[model samples]
Target chain A: MTHDLTTLVPLPVLIPLCAAGLALALHRHPRAQRTISVVALSLMLAASLGLLVAADGGPLVVDVGGWAAPVGINLVADRLAALMLSVSGVVLLCVLLYSLSEGMTESADGLPTPGGEDPIPVAIYHPTYLVLAAGVANAFLSGDLFNLYVGFEILLAASYVLLTLGGTGARIRAGAVYVVVSLLSSILFFVAIALAYAATGTVNLAQLAQRIPEIDPGVALLLELLLLLAFGIKAAIFPLSAWLPDSYPTAPAPVTAVFAGLLTKVGVYAIIRTQTLLFPDSPGVDRVLMVLALLTMVVGILGAVAQDDLKRLLSFTLVSHIGYMIFGVGLASEAGMAAAVFYVAHHITVQTALFLVTGLVERRAGTTSLDHLGGLARVAPGLAVLFFIPAMNLAGIPPLSGFLGKVGLLESGVRDGGTLAWVLVAGSVVTSLLTLYAVVKAWNKAFWQEVPAGVTRDVRLPRGMVGPTTALVAFGVLLTVVAGPLYGYADRAARTSMDGHTYVDAVFPGGSERGRGESPEAGGGDP
Target chain B: MNPEMVPSGVLVVAIGVLFAAGVYLLLERSLTRVLLGFILVGNGANLLMLVAGGRAGGAPIAGITPVDEMSDPLAQAMVLTSIVITLALTAFVLAMAYRSWQLNGHDEVADDVEDRRIARLAARNAPVYRDVDQGEAGTLDEDAAAARDETERDEAGDKTGEAT
Candidate 1:
């Protein structure tokens, strides 16, 4: 049974998927649907924790349905993969709680219907949310590139439904932009997959890790570029990122928070995987990524500075902070990669927490518009405190996890010792300062300023909403308290990601790099 | 694996043409054309995968193969998966376009006001590096700061009209 723990890798996707079907079937019973979804998610969290602990020893590779690797689907949970699962699981569980507490569970139209006549079918939200989780889980654990692409499609499809849940005009408009942009990128991803297979004859990550280096350098670079462009659009990097600020801010709060936190990070995760496992030998790609990272930081914050709406401002900042992770990825060093991984985990919590708090603010106040918001600090002092902690944490305030992650990244950047790297270091510092400025400005407008005469109504927040947000805030604080061990773990995870042998070995097993160089038939090496 | 078995060059030219048309439509603001572009691109990619699978021949049935020179089933499987994905996305995008048409009377993607604002600001904006002493000479520092804040507030006030 203990040996079978690695088998739990697929359980995260499986449990949620099964729950989604069950929940959808029970749509008339909202309470049962919530119970089913929550129970399934809690189970996933536990399994994710188990996977995290088991994976710490080494990569835990489970060939699904007992099929051999390369040909059959495989789920590999190394430290990096496990950490992503655990972190996202935490965020999802918390966001679900927050939405429930906020009474944001909905009918198909995403609004609470009056009486029992047209019942608000909270059932649909649960199933869609579950499917989204399954998709995220699949992406994190997939060993094959095609499987990863499927994971992305699953998540994006769920997200499309989630984004337009309420069917408001704004949401619909946002959904259109989102769908178009997403489709365009996914098509590119398909083309990239096609081209990669054309070049190498296999789409398994481990096999590609071996074979890609053997191809003509130009072809390899072209393949890597196609993959990057595809993932980059999804990640919301600059030049490819204009649609994000327009798209994310219009979704409902919980949807927006989750999208801000998890969705783009999936893209970042893919970029990290490709940079390390598949294209580690390409320094030029790393440099190109670094420059893009710098541009993303500068451009994103500038947009942030110009925004007056809270959600849009946060959306822009979300784009800005992604630069930090990309900066980490481009370093292509163990330390750089570790810091990047650490920063990713840190950003997910802090950004999601901030967005969740914004939701709370919106509930208390009438809106998240900075101009209309003021005097929240004096009125809803508790909400003000909630908003303050995460805002400061986001700004890289000392002793907070955000600061630690940035320092780790900066330390790595300095150690890399190139003019380009230093330029990124300077851009990162500027971006951090500007991020602090933007969020603090938001704090001053939304919390610190005096409330207007007419705006001093009831500010009481429901216990349910406050409880989950407090939990997330506490979780963010816990990252700081456990900074030593967490950073150590990230450092180790980084080292693991940088080394391709562990991944190659975990998936390939006794079959040495035979997936590459040989024919595609050889990789499938059937019974 | 054999050199002679790569897909016909004609397939490559067709894919290129499909990609070119797809990109041209993708750059348009009309949602219908964008959707069309997306479809074309997806088809192009599927065709690329077909070509990538080498020259097509026999069905990849398990055991008792009709011919050993079977098309690469993996690439076929990938294309099938992508086709399903593309179909699903097309339905979703069609709904979005329909909804957009219902609300706005046309299916054009509305330009983001903020994007336009930022672009305009960037175009007209040059570096403003005002020294503290010279710019506000003979004026109270608090007044200068207040002036700056007022300009910010006015700009923010202008933004308040957007209704989020």
Candidate 2:
């Protein structure tokens, strides 16, 4: 009478992994491959939703190859993992749908339609996109450090292909930098894992949690630092964030939006996991994190302010706003972590929505350069309304998810009232103001002002493309409206992550570090 | 313990030197030098990992327990993974260099700030003629002809000597 819902755990990873191979096979059969990719992704989205429902009250752990605890790698999906995965699934589904609707070929209306000379085939874009989404899901669900590294490689490999899909001169050049930096970070991650393994003899995050405490304090600190450096590079924390804005804006709108929305946050998520689970006792890490958070905020927004290109400006702000999440994590309070988790969810939606809106703006206005785009509201009032809500939310205005996430972090920081927390609080307020200014600058230039004389009227995006952008924006606003439920989920996730014992016991049984923790039979039988 | 006690300390210092030099070269605009810098950084990071693995002795293989030590196999494995990834990246970046050289006729990084300003200026003052041709021309491929038509219109308008 077993329903075998746990079988769903590996399906999300397996589907995409298989799709990557299938995608390569269908490279020749472009249409069939696209069908397979889209179907596979849709199934994955459905599976992710089911897992979310099943995991509503508790953690779901899948031990691979039927191996027992501590030896077999595990994939654990808790509330935070489930929420991130759900958002990623939904957003990617929208992007894939939009890509299909728009047709893979055509340059925001600049290129000829399909069946014309040099058809822009959907084949290359769709499959690689699925692979990317799959990698994101794997990263979110992985319970082992080494497995997470592999997930990152999967994502990076697919992104490298996607980023260079067009093989344009600019794209190739940008992809080159993006690929190299990502590879370097991956290597660093390997090094960090090696060190951690040396100290703990295991790569399972749960096992490491129990063992890391026994390792020499100095060695543990060194390992933590190495791991932090690696993840920080990926997340594009203040100092290591330089490669992002330069590379992201070079890709097509969907590619850029997905990368901006999901990829860096993966890095941030990794950092959160490592700090909370692996080295919770690492002294002075929070202080370092606080300082880095502030710098990330200041430098990122300043970079955004200086950019004239709408996409590039948004990209900078994307990196800058990462500081808020990092700040919440650095606070190391339960409220702080919950706020950080909520912020991650909120930012992913708003950021993705904004980027998609930018694509629409580019399509209608002939470019994303604010100076060149003026008075867009006059001709494209639909676009103006579409872009405005997320734009205001991004600047942290009230009733939106963005503002709620920010307020959560600021309140936690202010409540903590340490010097680092004070700095974070002050920096949060300042960065929000600066963020508002940057977004308004874009609005004034692109929407409010009179349309410049030289602008063309020929730019017309398909209904399919606009539909996704509008949907994501509406979805973000909905989250803002339904803040209570989302916050409760985030709070639960934060509490569970900090508890560590609940997570620890789920992977082990009597072997757990939790004193009163329930065993496998008491909850769900291991068999 | 003195920092100079281990003979491998020199290798560690060498790693530092590689890092500093690589970072300096990476900052340069030239593509080849940047590639070289990346290689150097890779090596330095590898050395750093190896050093962190503990005093190196012999090659680390399984089932070997020596007198108080074994060449930290974990570090060796880490280095191996990193080496493979670095090799892949090096090959990929070289391909990029080749393509960039083919397209731009130079391997230096583009001056993004300066180019952006120029692009902004050009976009801001785009002629009235550009807009008119866009109305009639269906695509960007006909952009040049569109610009030409718009320029002709502007000239004709100028000839009429009426400012609208």
Candidate 3:
């Protein structure tokens, strides 16, 4: 059964990549491009779901191109990876559908005249979106450190194109800041990987997990710090987050929704993988992480509270909610890790749904500015319900997955009983309340306030656009309904990751020294 | 670990200098300079990977070079991959920079509109400085008083005048 599942490991990455090539080739045939993209992503989602179920037994590892663990790249779909892959697959599919529907309406409107020419280059969008999906899958499933880096580059490259899709003045400016910052982070990550290889003589994650403990404490700490800094920038942890709000709001709504949902979460996922699998017991680093998490929550929400633009406000809230995941990781306990994983899943759905709803608002109301938006509740009652559910879910109102995840984190924090954990607990509650304030402020302005002049209320929302968004919001609600089993699976995943040996042993079943590769020196030579 | 595989001091220094210069250039506002800085830093990182592979040796060929004499093939492979990635990214950034220039007539990184707005607000709300604390020569307090409701201020002023 495990061997059978291992064959499915590469499908999520492979199918989309192959489809991307096909999509690019068929760019002239927009219908064919759409069909190929939809089919490829649906198959990827199926594979991810299969992996999610199979990986629950244990990690399923595949050595790509028949190369073994140490010498060759591998993809491992452990529980955490499988869970992340599944959520991302769902999100990518929904966003793709939303964009496709959007493109259809846009073409129908005949807005792309001689000068304006379609803000989103429709021909390239499918291929780039597919590549982005593949990249995200690769990042989640990669068992090798260097392969993870490759995955990051793939996704980031796609993101750059998406962010500056139309090459408008604002998008170009936003893309410049985004591209520069991401490049810097990538460079830092590369440096860290190089140094890690120097110290450990291997870039394979399983081998590193074995060898890292034997290295000098100071060198190990340096590697840890370097990796954290690199991932922190990607994850947009407090101090490294300024670029996100500025860059994200400039993109088209579907693109922004996907980025808001998946991109930074990839960084957070990396942090969880490394901190749990590679460096499991460092209280001092954990303490520092706690402090940073506290600041990220407070500062990010404060920024959110101050935003007049709805997209920008959502972006800030996205940054703020990342703090909760960091808080869970900072606790460095199984319970905390479980809650973090669950919270990550919850946040991805809720945040994406909110952004999609914002897109619908922009379509119906003509803008996403809180100051200009008004009477949406009276104008579009269904849209109001859609926005209200996800908005409340994000703010962690009772009976929602967001609230459940937060409660789990807070419970874990109290159990840890450390002063820093206590402070973070307090910080999280305050952040939650402030999030409520920010979203409510947006709600009141956008939904309840009198309609601003010159804004049309009679615009119709296309069924195609609303269908996928509604499905996604319903998926968010489904997370609340299935919270029990999901949290249980998360707990088991947390246990497996925190233990570390299960992952390493899965990669090198016999022992730490050898893989199936024929190379005499399976692991790399030492410096 | 091999005793003879120590990295050269000169190489390490070169890496440091490249990184320092790259970071300095990175802080500049122009997208062109930032792209150049990224290329420099990327090269420095590639060199660091080379250094990580230990002392240079013969090409890592199975039959052409002995095992002991062969350089670390893995590091070389990684460096080559990174170099390709950096090159691709360089092309993309160049395109973006050109696009930026075409759109705005310049390729300088612009400040975030929201951040700039906040900065402007902070400047406006900043407290004014006065040389003398008690003097009424355009003091901040006097300004506040002048800005207050005229009727309320007159009543308070009359009361204070009577006390004086």
Among the numbered candidates, top lDDT falls to: 3
lDDT tens string, model 1, A163-278?
98756566776787888889888888888888888888888898889888888899998989999999999999999999999888767678899999999999999999888999
Instruction: Identify the CAPRI category of the predicted complex in candidate 1.
Output: acceptable
Q: Which residue pairs in model 1 clash with each other?
A: A107-A121, A375-A451
- Cα lDDT tens digits, model 3, A59-104, are 8888786667887787888999999999999999999999887882
Q: Stretches of candidate 3 above 4 Å error?
A: A104-116, A519-527, B1-3, B122-164
- Interface RMSD to the true structure, each candidate: 8.6, 7.4, 9.7
TM-score of each: 0.90, 0.83, 0.92
Q: DockQ for each candidate?
A: 0.30, 0.13, 0.27
Ranking by TM-score: 3, 1, 2
Candidate 2 residues lying further than 4 Å off, grouped into runs, are: A1-3, A106-121, A512-527, B1-88, B114-164
TM-score of chain A of each: 0.95, 0.94, 0.96
Name the better of 1 and 2 by lDDT.
1
lDDT of 2: 0.76
Model 3 C-alpha lDDT per residue in residues B51-85, reported as the tens digit of each score: 99988899998899998999988999999999999
The candidate maximizing TM-score is 3
| Cα misplacement distance, residue A118 of candidate 1 (Å) | 7.3
Better of 1 and 2 by DockQ: 1
What's the interface RMS deviation of candidate 1?
A: 8.6
* C-alpha lDDT of candidate 3 relative to the true structure: 0.87
Q: Give fnat of each prediction, in order.
A: 0.62, 0.19, 0.63
Model 2 DockQ reads: 0.13
